[model samples]
Structures are given as C-alpha cells and as structure tokens.
Target: MDTRRPTIADVAKRAGVSKGLVSFVFNDKPGVAAPTRVRILAAAEELGWQPDPVARSLSTQRAAALGLVVRRDPTVLAADPFFPAFMAGVETALTERRQVLVLSLVPDAAAETATYRSLAAHRRVDGVLLTDLRHDDDRFPLLAELGLPAVCVGRPDVAGAFPVVNLDDAAGLRSAVDHLVGLGHRRIAYVGGDVGMLHGRRRRKSFLEALARHGLDPVGVVDTDFSAAAGARAVVELLAGAVLPTALVFASDPMAVAGLAVLQRQGVQVPRDCSVTGFDGMDLGRHLHPALTTVEADPLAWGRAAATVLLRLLDDGRADDLELPSAALVLRSSTAPPPDPPG
Candidate 1:
C-alpha cells in the first residue's frame, strides 16, 4: 500500500520483473514477451504508475510542447469558424496524450523565423506546425536549417526533408468547376485569392484547366485577397465588362456571400441570371439565399490530422508527410444553366 507517486521500480516490483523490463514496456520498446508485457501493464495500472510525460521527455532528450505558427491576425483567427473548428480537432488529438499546444501568430517571415529560433533554442517545443505557406516561402529553408521537426500545412516551392500536410486543392477546384460546367455554364468568371498563396495558385490553375477542357476560355479571372469586400469588388469589376459572365466561381465562402449580395443589389436573379459557386463550405453558405453551391472542406478533420502527425514527429522523432483528403462539391441552389438569350 505504498502510495508516494509510484515509479517504474514500483511497477517492476509489483509485476515481479526488473526495472529495465518496466522501462522497456513503458517506452514502447520491443523485445519484451507478450505475457510479461501484459502483466507489467496491469501492475502499472494497479499501482497508478502512469509514466510522467515531462519526466520521460527529460530523460529521453525531447520536448513536450508543440508549437503552432499561423501567419494571420490573431483576432481573425479567433473569430473565424474554420479555425475554431480545426482547433477543436487538434485539441481532441492532443488531449488523448495530455500534450500542450502553444500557438503563435507572426505577421511576417522575419518574425516567424525569430519565433521558431527562440522556441528551438529553449527546447520549449519539440515540433511545430506551419500554416499559410507561399511560393518560395522563407520558412521552408529556415526550418530546414534549424533541423527542427516541423510540418507545413501548405505546399511550399522549396523542397526539403520535412513532413508536409497538403490539401488536394487542385481536385477540390476541379470538382467545383465540373459542377458549374455540368450546370450548363459556359462563360464562367473566376474570383480567386491572392496569387501568392499556394492554395490560390492551385485553384486558379484548376480553373484554367477546366475551362480548356470544356473548350471555353474563361470570360474573366480576377485575383483578390481572402475577404468579402475583395470578393464584392472583383465581382463588380467582372460585371463592368461588355459581356457579363453567366456564372462565377469564388475562391472563398466569404467572397461568395459578398458576390451574392452585390448581384442581388444589382437586380440580378441568382440561378436565373447568374450562377455562383463558392469554395469553403462555411455554415453561412448553407443559409444564404438560394443557398450557395460550394466545395466542402472538412477543416476539423484536417486540423486533427495535422495535430496527430505533428505529435508523432514530436514523440517518435519521425517525420511523416501526408496528403489530406480533398474538398467535396456540395450542390445547392446558387448555380444553374445560363438564362436563354433573346433571339
């Protein structure tokens, strides 16, 4: 009945095994017999000798903290439903192992690099999660130089020996374009995100490929930042042309909502006059008037997957580059064939 925070020795004594055997079992090391392993586990559980993660890390030369670096406004991240949902998934994965998540927001590449270096120097975090990657991103090379266990959420042009978790952006966009084309849309306008981001680049490339496949050159291609206001402005610019497109593919749900409002204000009948398709299946998209046709990406699942992979890298000293599932096209009332032209 000794109850002073039972140690590995206590577990070994209770199981009638050596301390080394207990260590091997607790550290997930191979070579212990099956029957003996079960007995050791049961003894540890009975004595409440659950391995102290912090102490184990100290002995094993590993850090227990996981750093998540997001290059965006913290306020925007807090308010955005997508990030919150994704965080939920990440938390769920971490909770199972009782690990802490340290999130950081950096405005620029220099600040981001500084933060990573500080974290690494202090050995405060074993691994890091990098989001919002751009073409020729500085973080890619810097992370490689630091030799830190890291996972990038987006694909960066710089190739290195680090794990990456990339979304199937091209497939998602292809599905969106195919849906609109199937709806008899010929002159489709594209409202995309900043060309600097990899996801935006992939979306635009898919859009152009879809247009070529249909033997129809896109009527317009406007790039804007990921904001509702930007989406509205892009739509207006497209409409200013001599021939208005019959349908529009917006790169984000926020932009799609803005575009929808603009069309309504201009007395354009959605589906009847112009069809709209949006990426990111936001909750608001489902509630929009003539509900938005959108590509549904599961942010929660993506976040959980990212966290799980990062955790592995932290705990096992192994890097895993994984490609997550792509978004699915969710058809709704926002899209329809172009209205018949008067003879």
Candidate 2:
C-alpha cells in the first residue's frame, strides 16, 4: 500500500485512462464523455488521489486560481441576486479544477484597478474575469501591460487583444419592448444601471432600438446605480414626470423588485395603474407578488461560461471569443394593458 500523494500519472493508471483524459476531466474541459469522467472521478476517489493545487501551480509556474474584481457597492452586491448566482456557477467550474476564486468587492474604479494590479503583482491568480465593464475600460490595457490574461463578461467597445464572453441580450430587450407595446404601452420608460457601465449602455441602446423597431418613442430614461434604493427613487421620478409612462423597464431584477415595492407603497396598482419589467431572470422574481415580467439572463450560466473561457486561456495560451446562450423574455402578471382612456 503506497502512502504518498498521488500524481496525475498515478490517477491515469488507476482510472485506466490516458493522462490527457484525466486532465480534461479534472479541468472540466469539453469533449470528455460523461461515463469516462465519472470513471476517472471514481478511481481518483477510491485511491484518495487529489491533485495538489499549490504543487501544480509551482510546477507549472501559474497561480492555478482565477480573479474576479467587482466594482460595486457592497450593498448592491448583497441585494442583487445576479452576483451570487453567477458566482455559484463559477464555483461549479472551479470545483472540478480544485482552483480558487479570488473575489474583490471595491467601491469605485480606482480601487478596482488597484486590486487587479495587486493580484497580478502578487501572482495571486493566473487570469481574471472582468465584469461591470465601463466605457473605454482602463482595465483592458492595464491588464495587458501587466501580462495578465483576462476575459471580459460583457463585450467592451474595444477588446484590444482579449477573448470576450458576450451574451446575445438584444433579442430579450427587443422582446421586452414588443411585449410592452403589445400591452398598449405607448409611453415606455427605461430605468437603466449606471450609463457608464458597458452592460448598462448596451441594454439602454437595445431598449431604444427595440422601441424604434416598433415605431414607438421613448417617453423617459433614468440612470441608477443598480441599487434597490436607486430603483425606488427612479420609479418615483418617472411617476412624477409630466407624461407618465405606462410601462417601466428596469435593467436588473433587484432594481425592478425595489421599484415594485415603491409602486405598491405609493398605491400604484401593478399592471393596472402601471406595469413593470425587469431583467436578470432571478428566481426571486418568480415569487414576487405579481411574479415579475423580465428578460431571463442566467447568471449561473454566465459565470460558468466565463470561467470556462478563462480556464481554456490558461491551458491553451489563447482562446477564441465565445457567444453564450441568448437571453429571452419571460411573461408574467407584472405586465398588462393600460387602463381605458376617458371618453
């Protein structure tokens, strides 16, 4: 009976599979058959064989960990359902690789950049996943100069030389607009996240384009910090506007949920007095009083997909741009036709 740390070759021999197969399964790479993956895992467990992450990193001259720096207010991160769900998906991928996820929550862009630089200088991670992209993101060139490989969650205006994981959300945005228009919502208002953020701008653009496609004009637009409080405040402002919009589309589920609560407090009958729509397809939305109507974007899938690309880049030195599953619109009781006009 050998009483020593097992190596990749040992696992391969025990599993009766090639070393490459074992590597693929451990790294959660595609193209490995399900049965083979199961067999490999079973063999490794039976032999008490666990890959040493530190040893592997030392030998490979790589950190064997991934970094994610979120430039968000801590309150928003706690309130928003997307970040948690997305991180769960990232964990699922990291679990197989026995890798670590180094997450940093910063208040602003300055702190965020410092965090990235620190991570790179400390050799704390092999690559990073950049989220909450900003217009003319400084992280792109900074990361490139640091020699740190990265994958952007949203398509930056200028990718320079990095692989991006872009979700086709245009269809979902269009569907949302079309849904509102069908409900006799001629005056549609948009509540977006920080216009400076790449996703925020992209979604806002999509919302406007969707309206144009249906031959409707935007009645109002408000930008928020993607916080519940911000959402509530924006809702109040929209409701107080000269020409009240019958439908309000929010950029994220948390904001939408906040807006719904505000509407309820203000004696606004949802889908009766005014209708609301949210994005991010959070499960919490389904349990809301009226079951929120929203565009469904799977954060978990986004996380897993982004992690997959980052891992591939680490392994192969280079990876191609990946198009993730498209977002779609979900209909619920939150949206309805406007009330009849006075005769």
List runs of model 2 lying over 4 Å from the truth: 1-56
The C-alpha TM-scores of every prediction are 0.83, 0.82
Tens-digit per-residue lDDT, 111-136, candidate 2: 98789889999999999998887889
**Positional deviation of residue 28's Cα in model 2 after best superposition, in angstroms:** 17
Tens-digit lDDT track of model 1 for 1-343: 6557888888999999998788788888889999999999999999877888877766565666678877776665554556766777778888887877888888877788899998888887877777667887777667777777787776667786667877776777788788878878888899998788788888899889978888888999999877888899999999999779999998888889999989989999998999998988888889878999988887877778888888877656786788887888899999888899769
lDDT minimum window of 10 residues, candidate 1: 73-82
CA lDDT, candidate 1, residue 335: 88
Model 1's number of clashes is: 0
**Candidate 1 Cα deviation (angstroms), residue 180:** 1.6
**Off by more than 4 A, model 1:** 1-55, 74-81
